[model samples]
Each structure stands twice: as structure tokens, then as C-alpha cells.
Target: MKNKSIFLLVLTLFVIALAACSASGAESSSSESNASESNANSNSNEVIDIVWYPNESGNDMKASRDEIGAIITEVTGKEVEHHLTTDYAIAIETLINNNADLAFMGAVGYVEAKNGNDAIEPVVVPSGASGTLDDAIYHSWLAVDVDKQDDFKVDGEFSLDTLVDKRMSFVSNSSTSGFVVPTSTIIDYFADSSDYGDLTPEDLMEGGSLFSQVLFGNSHQGSAVNLINGNADVAAFCDNCVENYVEAADGEENTVGTVYRVKEGAAEPFNNVIGEEFILISVTPVLNAPIAANLEVLGEEDFKKIQDALASDATANNEEVFVPEDSDASGLFYKTDQERFIPVEDAWFNPIRELSN
Candidate 1:
């Protein structure tokens, strides 16, 4: 009987040990699961990195970029890293490839990027002086040196009919105001002519077809410099893009016959061309440029924040993003009583897209 008691007691102890072991295993599993959940929460809370790509036009506006960047950081709580580019294609590609979170580009560039990747969306665009999209535009000018302006005039008025076989300098084939708008105007105007009925934008890209020679300045400032330096008989650029460096020398501002001369103390490309004047032969209004974002990279929530921040009244009056005419601050936007950034829809650019078709 004593031997039986000893065996039963030993069995009882074994059972206790088995229960303890099972509880320990369960506790370990619970601890590991909690740890994994903690790690996931930490990862989710981590800040996302944002990259901004700017068109070549903004390459020289560092102070303006910093102010804009600060606003973005304030809204997102993430610092923005700028990727400066010298070509429109580079900025467009960067945004389409998801390598950049944001981009500042014209309607053409934004449309192209959206075509490459539908994930791109327009965040905001600077409004006209009246704070309305109806006049939210910039001018595309077909200009010639002051000395050659008379050669482009007919019957005492400026005309594009004399542009045939003239040497031309275009900012970039991808440029909206510099190339797309101006080229579309040329194609439309000459489509009714018997000899040039088959003319296409491609035909004007090379020297032998219509122009004596074709040169791409790669930037608005560069295109204006090309004309002033005698590299091309005529050139295409935007009014506002060169506003900081040029002022009206003859006629009215933005008028087709107006002549603009480089400011005396203008920056780089314009420094040597100072005092040189270019007369506008053609002036066409184009849609305002937009600040575009990659929806996939920014996500809907974060993108909304950025879009709202940019369109806020505070940003409009910041003076740094939209510099006042009298202010010495250099900025991407020019300030007026009602000028501000406004949210835009993708369908708004359909008109620009139609020009290509």
C-alpha cells in the first residue's frame, strides 16, 4: 500500500509539472504576439519622406523654394527634399515614376505625366490677379529683336505670315507656352495655306522644313537669351517667366507690339543681354501652371493636407510664395490683391490636351 501511495504521489507531481510547462508556453506566445504588434505600431507612426521636383524655371529661386518647403513641412510635419532639374522632361519623369512626391509644372507637363501614370493629380494652381480661373493665364510671345521687328511686320502691323523660313529659338519642345501653344498657333494659322496644309509641329522642329534653323534654349530665360544674342531670328518664351529681368521699353506691357528690355542688373543669362530689347510679334494666353502631386506616393489623406495648405489664404499672403511687385523678395508667384493658389480639377486641362490632338 505504501509503495502504491509513493507511485500515485509521483504521478501527481508529473501532472503539475505538465500544466506549468503548458502555461509557460502560452505566456511566451502571448508575449511574442504583443511584441510584434508593438513593432507594427511603431512602424506605422514613422514619418514618410517626401521629395519635391521643380521645373527648370524655379531652379534659380532658392529663397522662394525654401519658403514653400517650410509651408509644406508645417502641414505634413515632414521635411521636403527638393530635386532641382534643368529640363522639363526630367521633372515630369520623376513625378510619373513615383520618384518624386510633388512637382511644379505647366499644364503640358502635368498632362504628360498623367498620361504616363494616371496616379498623378493636380493639387493647386496660382490664380490670376482677379483670383479667378477665367483669367488664370500667362502669355506666350513670339518675339524678335527690336532691330528685326520691322521685318516681321506687314502693312504697318505685326504678323506671323513673315515667320516662314525664319530661324527660331524655342524654349523646349515640352514647354507649354514656349513651344506647345506657339506651335499650335502656327499650325492652325497655316493649315489653310495651300503650300503648308500638311504642316505639323514635327515639321517645324527641324531646320529644312519651315525654319532656316531650329534651336532649343531648354528654358524660358535661355530662349530669350538666344534671341538677344542673335542665335535665332525669333524666339518663344513667357511674359511672367522673364518679368523679373525685363521691363517694358516700348508700347504696352504684354501687347503684341510691345518691346521689352532686360533690366540693368538682371541675373545670369540676362546680364549680358541687359539693355537689349525684344518685340512681341504674337501673344497668346495659356493656362496657369499647376503644382501636381503623385497620388500613389502621397496617399489621399496627406495629399489633401498639402493641397489645402497651399490653397489657404495664409499662403496667398505669405509674400514669399507670392511676392509683391514692390517687395524685393524673389518668388515663383507674383502677388496682387486677389492673386492666390486655388484647387483645380484634372478635367480643367482638357483644352490644353486638345491642342495636341
Candidate 2:
């Protein structure tokens, strides 16, 4: 009887011990889950800094920047800081090094950043007027002074054949529209020529057989100024970058042979070239730029919040962000009935990557 009693006691102790162990395990698991939540909360509350490419760093873009920043701030409950840069490389490096939480950049710059740091990812891109990727594009132009427009014609048709031996200005080597697309077009156009069949982008980077001189404008506005100032015979720039400062002077918009002139009260880089006209000799459509982020810095939860906020209807209908044609608002985005921001994956930019290949 004493032995039976002892056995019962031992069994009771074993049950108690097992219950204690299970409780401890549950506590540990709960503690770990809480810690994870805390970390995510801390990250979400952290301030986000956005770096801008030189093209959009001017004071004229402040309203647009503030509008976009406001949207992010509203959704994340975190303050936002805008880091305006005067150089593309600075903005790119800032994001790659994690000094900036996000960046607004072209496809080439985004590709460069992603190549530099795998953590960088595309968050969203502004869609075309159709509210889809089908028409989400901007134009890259090879332009010259209107007075010299006729000089580029061959057999009553405008052509790129006269570009050889001319002085050229490009926004920057890292620019997608300003350099990559234009150069690719040039290389492809001259690939079958007997004298230049083996032409490459590098050959056109500097002055030599291909050009009389090559100049780096560093910005789209700067490139347009170069052509207007007579510093270059032909210059490369983008339509959206200079659209706010220039007005259509002649021909159809986005069409080759169209002429654009700087406005009367244009801001400083273009101020000196006011009333000057440049005609497009070549125009090629390119994918729209993207607002990219550093996933490591933003953390997954916060990044999702930001991504969803940007793709929401509130952002699309915001006048300050997607300015209307009749509105005098100086902003980055132009609104169409169906225009909006859309999420995109890394593969969306493969075409830009293919250029280098």
C-alpha cells in the first residue's frame, strides 16, 4: 500500500513538471513574438528620407516632392525628409549605402543601384494615361537649334545620318533617356554602315571620329541649355524633364521635327536660354521612371505600407501629385483621366538591362 501511494506521488510530480515545461515554452514563444512585433513597430516609426535625382531637385519640384512626402507620412505616421541632389551618382550612392531610405530614379539609375546593392528594389512606377503599363512611357529626344534643323535632312526627310562629326551634349552617362537609349539607337542605326558597322556606345562617349566634341550636361535641363547656347550641335534630353520649362513652338508634340522653346520666365539654367528653340531630330519612347526603395532599411512591413499607399486611389487623385493640364500647379506627375501609380517587379526593367548586354 505504501509502495502504491509512492507511485501515485511520483506520477503526480511528473505531471506537474510536464505542465511547468509547457508553460515555460509558451512564455518563451509569446516573448519571441512580442519582440518581433516590437522590432517591426520601431522600424515602421522610423523617419524615411527620400533622395531625388538632379533632374527633379530644383525648387520648381518642391511642391511635387512635398505632396508625395505628405502621402507617405500620412500612411506610415513617420516624418519624411527630402534630400535633393545635384548629381545622379550622389543620389544613387546615397540609396545604395542606406543613407537614404528611398530614391526616385530612371531605369538606368535603378539598374545601377540594384547592381550595386541587391537590397534595393523597385516599389512603384507612375502608369500611363490609360492607368496601365500599356502607355506608361516618356520620350528621349535628339534635338538641335531650329535654325540648323534643315541641316539634318536627307532627300527631304530628317535623318540621324548627319549626327556624325557633330558636337553633342548628353545629360549624363548614367541617364537612361539622356544617354543609354539615345546611344543604343545611334549604335543600331549605324550598325549596317560600311564605315561605322562596328560602332559602339563607348566610341561615342568622347569626341573623336564620331563627334567633334562631347559634353556632359549633368542634367536634362542642362543638356537643353547646351544646345540653345550653341555649345553643342545636337543634345539629348527627355520630354518630361523639360516640359514644365518649355512650350511647344512648332510641329506635333513628341514627333520628330517638333520644335520646343523655353518659356518667357523660365527658371535659371533655362532662364538664359528663354525664347530659344530646339527641334527634335530623333524621338524614342522609354519606360517611365520608378520610386525605388532599400528593402533592408525599410523593412518588409513598412515597405508594404508605403507601397500600398503609393498605389492607392488617394495618390492617384491628388492634384499636387498628378497635376492637371489646365492647372498651374508645378508638380512631377501629369494627371490623365485614368493615370495612377502601379506596382512593378524587378523584371519590368529587363529591357533597360538588355541595353547593356
Q: Best TM-score goes to which candidate?
A: 2
Q: Write the per-residue lDDT of candidate 2 for residues 196-309, one digit (tens) a residue.
A: 778778888899858889998999989989999999999999999998899889989999888898988888788777898989988888778989999888778767777887
The lDDT of each candidate is 0.73, 0.79
Q: Give the TM-score of each candidate.
A: 0.85, 0.86
lDDT of 1 at 289: 84
Worst 10 residues of 2 by lDDT: 21-30
Candidate 2, pairs of clashing residues: none
- Model 1: per-residue Cα lDDT over 73-104, one tens digit each: 67677656556666777777877876667778
The C-alpha local distance difference test score for the whole of candidate 1 amounts to 0.73
State in Å the error of residue 60, model 1: 4.1
Residue 267's lDDT within candidate 2 is: 86
